[model samples]
Target chain A: MICLAAFIVFAILGIFSATHRRLAKQAFWCVLRRVTFKPCQASIGEILKGKIVGWLLRRKSRWAGWVHRYFEVFSWIFVIITLVSTFYTVKGAYFYIRYGTCNPEHPEQCLISTQAALEKGVINPYYCNDK
Target chain B: MVENSWKSQFPFLMQKKNGQPLIYFDNACMTPCPIPVLEAMEKYNKEFFSCGGRSNTHFGRDVDDKVEETRELVAKFIGAGASQEIIFTKNATEGINLVARGLNLHAGERVLVSDREHNSNLIVWQVLQKERGIELMILPSKSDETFDLAGLEAELQKGIKLVSVVYSSNLDGYTLPVEEIVKLARKYDAFVMLDGAQAVPHHAVNVKKLGVDFLAFSGHKMTAPSGIGVLYGRLAHLENLSSLLCGGHSVKDSRYNGFELEDIPARFEAGLQNYGGIIGLGEAIKFIKQVGFDFIAKQEFELNYFITRELKQIGGINFVGVDDPKSRGGIVNFYHEKMDSNQLTIFLDESANILTRSGRHCVHSWYNSRGVKDSIRISSYFYNTIDEAEKLISALKKILGLV
Candidate 1:
């Protein structure tokens, strides 16, 4: 399932690259490097110098290089987004377990937390349906 | 205005992710529980958090009463003759398995199913066939994905013991002709079981009116919480079917050598039940009643028509199933020539904040037969709006370069 999810993420990044080239390239590099920091240092030509890209380089190096450079920045952005989302999910689950809510300030948004608060007799304003 | 107002009833719809309003179009997967249903579950956990049907304590007794009341409501909702005919399981898969495994079938007996059945309905029968030496006949569908009634009748003539079919296709949302299928099965003296996991949420299904012997559905698909499902069977069939699980609540009396099983529903529901989910389902039924099927159906039809029309305007987009949108429920499965369906789904989710499902949708048999691997499925419920559909269209156009 994780592999399928990664494949889907990359595929979407590839498709979205059509309109948003720089963002997609940044996303691709960020994911390939597994980093959440600044992605300007890594060049697309270096990233695309893999076996398949190598074979393409042998025949159409200019085209392959162009494609790699185009998608470099956006790919890094996608990776950063994915990493941040994963971090937030883990944080949310932890909060939900400890405090019965994903967001401490907005406990009403989490049903688990809301139910827990209601059981404990804590007034949850978000779920207030007295009317 | 109707869309905006109805959408507000679900709190999850009010959520914003990445500065975009969440456009949830994956209702067929599982619906976001509305406030009423959530509150109903909260009430159970807060006030009567006790084991049901087994204790003599006041709390337990009260919980049991609420459970039975919910059972009665469910019975009335599905037009069952008595509440005892309703057995609550973990989910629709468990309900279907209870019926599939409990039914006493001899070797060489056949079970008929449609070509478009979900894995829950198909895999259970496949296991039964492998274990019991029963023949599992898969009836074919037409080019448009509608079941071939003539083909089903031919299979029925071969002396089928049971005919189990999905009431609606999860892949393309094509609804089966369950009434006609049940009538034909009756003529063949075969019992009919309808997997109502998808159907019950969208349609007002009455088991008695449909003349089906058994029906299975999940609460999560109908604005209720997960881990609660219903298996509705005829009283006579319930009496004859064996209990799939045996434990504390299922037995009437047990001796050193022999044990007497309890009657109907309790005999089937063996372990401690999901009281919170069951109570929430009762509330879901109430909410559905308040909304009314007329409103639900009208809203779904309009959303489906609008989406299909918009999709048709986009080039390189092909929809699965019949040409008429009304024939299917509020689901649209389409593929793009320019991009993978999985990729398109992710783009919709990440870029557009619109959620949709993609893949074979647990109906790999249909895909395997057609040699088609995957497609994108957009399922709309009553809460979905025209604006959401427009967002989806706009996203698809941008992703596929149709803009």
Candidate 2:
């Protein structure tokens, strides 16, 4: 689970750094192993655990103990949060591409649509809701 | 730091991370450059940056002189017959390739290697076996993981043409009985080449006295800059050996059809040489001489002994290499049964600024053959101090949940 979250994080960071790109590749392989039901060779996830735990151990000992104890639960939470955010981001991009508003039901809340709508004097949800 | 130590001489040791000195124990991979080596390269680059053995200008002449001086320095350092025996290369890998291809082995010929050879040494022979149909035999070590002289003799009896092995095992820090290996190879009338990458910086190897046909090592492993290596070949063998590169400095008389090759070292060194790296390597060798090998050996022994002795009390750790710290020199490797080496390595880095190497360390064959997945290797040098070793012990103990 942590490997999944690490893959996403490293995949995004891979755009800038070669070091992160290598970790992204490692995380990709670990994710593949997990999906295939093989033993997870989650070297990236383990390194991430060490980094997070090591950082916390230095600054916040109580948080470090809690994190070390429930690392798996935190991994699942991270994965869930990432998945939910990804779904909403993709949905928003699709609505924006098709209807000129990130949210068709609440076009006024989206600044890109709100600014354009304000210029056209149609600052109401009903304008984008027609689609 | 030890008395009269070269620790303060290294600029990397002077650097601090999070208000503490960074503990660097990855010297087997490459040593950090000292002020002298860096200054030499910077002087070459800043003052007279030109191609050696090519240009006729003043700068080129200076480069040529410096390159030749470095060649002499390397030759003297290794106790070679002449400076012509030293061939400058990019790294030990390139040097190995130069010899492997230059030998021009035929089908059905045999080359013997140890079971614990590095990828650079093993891969070339494997390629030769597949492409050229040469018989490549791996001589197995003893149960104790040391070099098996009997197994070498058995392989030699089968008409082995060449014997190529690491002078010191990078994985285990086990020094091979190279003298005996060379003696047996001579009995079988086989050419011997020693991969001296790990041995050159830590040990005093005299090619004239030790008597191996070819020896290869990288400059970066000895506190010089990267992209520079040395391949010392016997004067007779280098003359007979085929050149792997062509054009520029390689040729003497070129025509439309064919050309005559240049002499010994120049023949092997084909293109424009790395003038800066060569100058830096010369300075590094000079600095090493100033520090002396006796001090280096003592410093490494003290640090490695402390590390191994402390690690012994930290249970659940499987030590790599032979048990003797003196035999292992500066290298000490191990892995935890509960924790994978990758995480342990990162934890060591995160807890303290302890730089180390992990995984099979380019010797995947040894680990795969033994069914071990990973390992954490801690290789020290003279620059490392006891304080760094103590910090590494503390961090490792914490990582292992001992504290």
Candidate 3:
């Protein structure tokens, strides 16, 4: 539980920092244009050249829409995997509480309903053959 | 007082073998001691060298008190009922032999043992069965060189007198299901004796909670001096058993006609005791406790993972035991058809400055049974680092390629 809470807090802090950097970059570009008293920053040819090189080298393709769609699909898959693993760890911990550990001999003892053993002063609810 | 590093404890470990620093990975055979254990033994040898409980003199009484204090420390460490239950022997082998010799095994009775047992645990029973006209029932092991629970249960269903097993296989650091074994022994009315040479140092071994009748382990494996280890028997069993060795301190009154015996522990501990070694063992355990078992387990587990991953990359190096740290401890065993284990060890030592144990590891019968002629073993302790493991892996790969 504590680990989950810590992860959430760190995630929020990371997103906040990323947004702050993006906003700062936009503000700086606007200030530079105003200081130079110019409506436009660069020639279309120069901009197109840089974009083409970046797109081919870094962004992979000129079809920006499909690239963004692929990234979004992969990002969602990554998030799902992370969330599933988090749940798996939580499940393991819960089972550890229910049955002491994952002793193969007593797999049934790892269930949550084995809490009655705790009342009976049997702290190791996980030992499948505790009886 | 708080010596945290391995070099500080076992300075010899840091000494260069060739041009490289000695990377000792044979912990299953014996561990290098820390400074505190050495100092404790030094104090005993230099200042307080007296036979315990033999004389009423000042030195004798002081030595007696120190011996008892050491006993108390060992007893508490294992969670034994009392200091009286803990018997100081030469080593775990002698301790197990004591039980084999002392326990009353009838001619028709059976002694149960697992397939994964070290020869120390196996051969003693075999010798007893041959000498004393008892039957030795060998329990089958699983495919992974581990005790088969179901097969063990089938064996336990029989009328067995004693169940002698290893808590962890020195061959591969595979831990047995101790709690389950103890429970089954209870059902069959058998006394369980654990060869805990591999388990005690790396993990938390609470004898009372584990509820075994007798437990034996060597001090050398736990960073103590050799020839001074323990045999922890329940007080009832200790009182009931016969002493195999008899001499000074064991008898109450000796005459030309007859002799009367003293109380247990002392009765079992005959001759002039290993005063220096016992005191050193006590200090070694104290040193381990100070660092903490949990920390030790965690460090060794990480090392085990690194070793497994690295070794897996090398082809034909078959690792024994359940590769997970949660199930196993810090011992890794591997064998290759290309080279002999001893040859591998020699190359690793001469070329790479890595110290590894090879061959049967005192469990000859176990190796023979599985058709494994020899195997290279790398057992780690908390003091071992990932870098040392890498060195060992590289050496092994080099040796493997050569063969």
Candidate 4:
């Protein structure tokens, strides 16, 4: 039910956004611009020379942008990974619920031994994977 | 797919190696592909790669159309009354397995099989006998590997329920009289299944006129890609049998308590099928139609006669079956006086780059029945020339001299 809701929402948004070309282009460009590398405040000399060796040297810390970049990359990766995993889980669950087995092709026939089916109780009759 | 002549269809066969044009004599095992099959597969993979019948979208409908188009082509090729009678399977192995498992054979019910069957037919029955308590009865073969009709009739008199036989012997290249066998089996109410893995490519098969209960054939052996096969069941027989595999797509409606299965073909297909392979297989059949079966059979017979004449000169080599072209299709299986088939195959590969099927050709029981271990099989296609047969005979002599 949740997947269906999300799919419907996304499909409608996709249709609406496809028609609004300027807004769609602006949104895509914003993401592209955000991911692109920016000029760093840290000078080459300061990067090469450590603070302990050159106490007289003064430079601004680029710690804020560096931290932001790390968080952005990590979050983007996390979102993509989460979405992919959710899809797999949904597919697996769908087949399991529909046929009472992961493999729909040989449902009536036992791919596994009868003993394994008795022990696992509908979990993976073919293999004794840890429940 | 647009139809083209054989000369225009497969230019690959005309390709030359070492200033000599190649000759392909390996059709009984696998045939060379024509351009239409490759193009169809490529077009589907690029344009219609989606789940068919599962999703209600343009791409999904495209996939469904492609799959059904192939099914119709295959049905027409075999003279099936309706496309719904044809079920797409992975290969001849899976197609046979589908029948083996789907039909519930009891402990006392008998399955009569010939000794000349390929392992695809033999081992499946054996597995069923071992697992399901079904009894398997073996029918004897003639010295030339032809079906012993009297022996089969004697067995039939004993009240057998099913008789599965090969339409053509891949080991010895003899074409069985399937129409006679079918008529005989029908008299006793015994179902007949024909393994057309060898015969379908070389000749025309009218399933309706043949009046067999089922016919199984693979695509790869007939210029299509591998991983695709057809299981043609009479619609009435399929209606009586229960499918072992059942899933969402195979069902019409469900109330969480009971479900109704779909019609013949849909009820049999329980998962995502090989859509591209089926589409390509359809085009392959179209290509074969353009070449004309009469021309194909004549070319194969001429080549078979030429090979038999050449091999007869190489004395001490024994061909297992009758050497008459009228009796066989294109396969010619023989063994030398004192040469291991594997060793000879290796020698041919190394010396002449000739490809031939060695060992029992997946029909171990056939060899076991003859009290022999294995034989070398040189099967030919229409594309093969008389010169290649001579070259193969020359290579056999060289290998035999070493023995």
Candidate 5:
């Protein structure tokens, strides 16, 4: 799910960039290179930075490079967040499947188990005694 | 004072992610199943784990009895005349398709659908038009996003065979005048089918009182599992409408040349069925009944009204439908002229842990026709509260760069 989310973001970015003639060529080329595992003449970072901050770089190279670097950092942070969230979500699902609760310590928090108990008119043995 | 105690019933509402409480305002898309509903499904899977409606074994018979009991309960909940009127499907989309494909409209016959229908309701008719040479008529809405009754009357005069429409708009939560629409359609001898996917969860739908020939809705939208949905047709319609699928339990007897079909509901429901989901849906209806529609409506209204009032103070925000919160259901769809909807949605998710939906919301034709693009949708439910609404507004303010 996390990979799909990242791919969707990239695809949307690619589509948005397609409106720009120069950036469209570069974006498509980047996609092609990534798909085929071909070595590109320019690094992806350089290509993206040059395209996005090219105008800024022409006027103020230092400021543009600084902003571009921050952009790269933010992108990595977003990716990391997505990965961590996806890991937890998958982990929760596994726990729920195995124990009928995402968190065994708080069995009432397990929706599946709670619902099962509720339907059967029985108390959730793990959490029923807890206030 | 309205008791906000219902929030405790949904475990997901209590869930925290990244040390922040997950504020879910995407109930229109789907709702998290309450404990009882989940329990019902779990009970089915754990204790009575058997194929339903086909086996003579003790477990199978018990499962069959439970499935039938669920059918009766669903029928009673929706005010259907009999349990046979309800047919279980994979989801509302399949229900709509079953009706569209089963009705067997002839060439040049027309079907009228409103402009605000979700893609599921709209695309099926379009497909029918393309394949069967049937004319698809668009029932235009009034400026305030309510159904144009006069426009529907005009269309009815032109001889429509069927009038299929959304019970409530998923985009803006504006409910069409279904009672009036049904009366008008009946005057022209037209069959009426309502896509009640949005309406059924929030409102008490009495098909008999509404006088509609058919109503389809998804169980997941109303706190049941995803795979289960209900298609309620009047007894006569179910008896006459062609079965979309065949084989297995759908038939009484079969041979190479010919086969005998079962009764109304069973004839339409083919294969083994989603027994777990069906049982969960039964429990969901029980939960809804216990909560009562009046309380649900009041709770949703409080949240929606509060959010709408707050959103009005924000600059650059344009609401999709009527300005009055009372005029719509629990949905608030808006777009910022200066901000991208998707970007705003992501910002809210990342910054505040508030989940929402942004896009054309499956009403692409409505957006495309009006030259409007994407919008953000915040749909509140009974489980949501004013505090959550306030949180959403604060997040929106920050995302709009207002704070």
Candidate 6:
């Protein structure tokens, strides 16, 4: 449902603004109803879709049509992207704390953590995880 | 531009808003005030800002005079029997509430209302039906969405106590037949009141000639400020209606133990009233009289015809009420079968600064009954131009990808 994606977006936006905070609450309720197998009776999903497509319609009619027609599909894509992104972020944090490198498989990829090890005058930067 | 049009008079339309010209089509909600109305309010607020009816100073005297003159102007504007019949209210809803509480109907007494009433006209009666043990009857419209006079006759025959209905529907702009309704009520010896918020702005409503017992309309719906409204009643009826609020200015004389209520208008109006709003409304009425309703009506008809005709060419657009635009006053109410009304207007606003009202529009009862979730409502006033209508069409066309 578009409500889940809208909830994430509004929740992120809600941190800095009161208007988006109110909308985030509505999106929360809509997502709650949806997960409970009830309808998205709050109508916030349609409103969010309208806002997005309406903005697009100002610049490109074709994009407006595509998005308006399959907004639900796009919402699914956003949710999947969010879940994947969250999983990687949490994993990166855990690895950085455990082994002094965010990417233990390729220590050089994490310049900040690798640089910190190099600062201690290690002959090879892999020494941070190898030890 | 149409000759003798008041477009130049409204300061809001003089320039572009955010590099795009603004086209305001939401007159049913509230009309923008002209310069004269604004100036009159400014003059009052700056010059005679003193408390009216409380001091013997020149400022207080001017305020009192201005207030009385405005009352007389309102009485003449609506053709009431006398100025004593005009009671200044917060808005039309307060006027209707005053009547609902004032009438003091007993248990089993009946009040009939049309199905397409504004919430102001509907909810007050519903509260009464609950609290006072009165019977609230809903009169359904004809299949064509016009008022059913035969239905009224039947309901009157069934012994209705009062008939309160909207003079013109804010939902779709379909006007009720007030003459026949008044005749039926008079024949049945029942009181008739009109919620004139929509009617009084564009129509020449003469309540005395029409023999209506009570009428209510908002000043902001015309060209005035928001806080002022008029409630017109026959002097006899007003004498009988109870005051809804009582405090500082509502009483004639006060004692440690008791106080006497002031006469008529003062008896009902109970505070430091909206003097600025009243002055603005008076000036607005003056402007309306100078422009004339004939010109207002003609401008409205031309605009509605153009908008309705062009909107029809768009896909899946179904109109509310009659197909004819002229008969629907200044309102063009409809929804797109392919596009949600809320979405459609959002797109319109996104493309251009064009404005319109959408969603349930406060007639949830009618919409709920007809299974309509929403509608887009646009209205044209005298100041609204044919160019604005074309802009609206072009905006809609752009949204639909037809242009």
Top candidate on DockQ is 2
lDDT of 4 at B355: 68
Better of 1 and 6 by lDDT: 6
- Off-target runs (Cα >4 Å) in candidate 2 are A9-29, A38-44, A93-131, B1-5
Worst 10 residues of 2 chain B by lDDT: B1-10
Question: For each candidate, what's the DockQ?
Answer: 0.02, 0.43, 0.00, 0.01, 0.02, 0.34
| lDDT (tens digit, per residue) of candidate 5 on B330-373 | 99999999866765676566557788998899999999988887
In terms of docking quality, how is candidate 1 classified?
Answer: incorrect
Per-residue lDDT of A59 in model 2 = 67
Off by over 4 Å in 1: A1-131, B1-4
Relative to the unseen true structure, what is the C-alpha lDDT of residue B226 in candidate 2, on a scale of 0 to 100? 92
lDDT of each residue in B113-147, candidate 4, tens digit only: 88878899989888889998898998887765578
Native contacts recovered by model 5: 0.00
True contacts kept of each: 0.00, 0.42, 0.00, 0.00, 0.00, 0.42
Task: Please compute and give the TM-score of the first chain of candidate 4 against the native first chain.
Answer: 0.30
Q: Report residue B153 deviation for candidate 1 (angstroms).
A: 1.2
Per-candidate clash tally: 24, 0, 3, 0, 3, 0
Q: Which DockQ-derived CAPRI band holds candidate 3?
A: incorrect
Candidate by candidate, in order, the iRMS in Å equals 13.7, 2.9, 26.3, 36.0, 12.9, 3.8
Q: What does the lDDT read for residue B155 in candidate 1? A: 85
* TM-scores of the candidates in the order shown: 0.77, 0.92, 0.73, 0.71, 0.78, 0.89
Candidate 1 lDDT tens digits, B199-273: 888888899999999999999999999899999999999988988889989999999999999887898989898
Question: Alpha-carbon error at A93 in model 3, in Å?
Answer: 83
> What TM-score results for chain B in every one of the models?
0.97, 0.98, 0.96, 0.93, 0.98, 0.98
Whichever of 2 and 3 has more DockQ, that candidate is: 2
Model 2 agreement with the true structure over B116-223: per-residue lDDT tens digits: 899999999999999999999998888888889998998899899999999988887788999999999999999999999999998899998888999999999999
Cα lDDT of all candidates, in order? 0.80, 0.87, 0.76, 0.73, 0.82, 0.86
